[model samples]
Target: MTLDPLAALAGLGFGLSLIVAIGAQNAFVLRQGLLRRHVLAVVVVCAASDAVLILLGIAGAGVVFAAIPWLTTAVRIAGAAFLLGYAVLAARRAVRPRALEAGDPQASPGLAATVLACLALTWLNPHVYLDTVVLLGSVANTHGDSRWLFGAGAAVGSVLWFTALGYGARLLQPVFARPAAWRILDAVIAVVMAGIAVSLLLGL
Candidate 1:
């Protein structure tokens, strides 16, 4: 289908607004980057998953997502709990420093596992559904004949953002390899996750 510039721009703007936020998914990506884990796999998985969701949104399937009130609430609760647990784990990691020796890349996470993890992180979050599929799609649908253009723009935005997040964080790997830096980063992640959990609980 032919793409419309105005619709594409609108979708691009919407995608940026929602995806640029620092949240659980971003934290996960940053963690993977810090550990120097399956970087390419993680980026591909996240970007591809976002493309699919944006397409689904453009296809008018957003209503289905909106209809699942209970499911969304359940996901939100689960996400909050997971974040809190992760925060505790991060706090522990911060307190106990691990050896800085790099492990064999081959022994780390595989492509399939990385993809699955990213998919679960993206799909299991109620916020993703509401922001990308429901709210963003609703706005794009108002474009009438240019709806698919909006989806394409959103898909592109996802690719750009995920690549930047997954790869860009790697720039700090050299610094983070130091035991002290690792502790600080871990502590920051813990605080961010805990704050997010509280925010979710307060419905903020």
Candidate 2:
């Protein structure tokens, strides 16, 4: 039941490894950061969502995910499809450079919507379950009763990372203001998303 420092460190490292990858959540965070629009809100939603999932994983949700083979397969297919769709959308945005709507200096996605979006992005994706719940949880297995501490460490890491990424991206806002820069970024996102989708589909 005691907190094992080694297990906590392993869990923290594993959590960070899975999160640092580029994905829809990262893309959204970067956009919000660069626009200085809802940056804090995005971070709160993302971090809290991760905390919940990480806890669930520590509580053996990974076993549930693994138990249902068909469900896992469905999630994989769905996640791949969503990635491809998002890729197409990104490519369209790149081709048709449209002016972004004036960000409401005060307007923001409602708390409910923000929470829902975060949960959907974090939970609905099979990759999240596979990486955080399964992979990271497996690392905490040695902690036995102290698995909660491991999950806590992982949650703390998620909070730290999201905050850094959200705010760090704002530093590049001035450079991204250029229309060409936006186009290029969109193109890059499209390519990345497409590549991820292909990788998932091929089970790579």
Candidate 3:
């Protein structure tokens, strides 16, 4: 099948626009990237999960999700709880900040725990479903037969964004070398997490 370049570009742009926002997932990714703690695993999970979700959306999972409102409601409750818990953790980290030094064995979490947290941050968040499955799916459908191409483009966009965010974060290593920087970042992450949690609880 011939891919539509225009459709692909449009998908790329749209996907980046959505994922680049200062949301819970991005905040978690940024923190992990800055810490260089299991950065590769985290980036792969996020980007791959997004690709799968966007494809599902393009495949009409949005309609199925809408038809079963209860599923979303259940996920919403779980997501809110998870976000709130994460916010508290971030708040504690902010209150007692640690410098994000690479290879600092004491400061970094194990790979299993980090991967689990990353998965939770990705899958447990309802906005992911809304954005990728529902919203992106709806938009892709507008392209008619070219919708799959749009989805493919979006998948590419996800890969690029996550790769950049994860790897490009190394450039900020100098700044995060200071404990003060870590404190500030954790505080911001706490606020973002709490705000998202409240929004989920309020059904926003």
**Model 1 lDDT at residue 200:** 67
TM-scores of the models, in the given order? 0.83, 0.84, 0.94
lDDT of 3 by residue, 149-183 (tens): 88888999999998899888989999887888887
Ranking by TM-score: 3, 2, 1
Clashes of 1: 0
lDDT of 1: 0.75
What is the lDDT, from 0 to 100, of the residue 70 in candidate 3? 89
RMSD in Å for all candidates: 3.0, 3.1, 1.7
User: What are the per-residue Cα lDDT tens digits for candidate 1 across 1-204?
Assistant: 555788887777788888998877787787777667877788787778788878777777777756766766677787778778778877877786453323535223576766665666677676787788777778888888898888888888888887888879878877876778867777887898888777766762
Model 1 misplaced stretches (Cα beyond 4 Å): 1-3, 99-116
Of the two candidates 1 and 2, the one with more favorable TM-score, higher being better, is: 2
Which candidate leads the pack in TM-score?
Answer: 3
Per-candidate total of colliding backbone pairs: 0, 0, 0
Off by over 4 Å in 2: 5-7, 100-118
Better of 1 and 3 by lDDT: 3
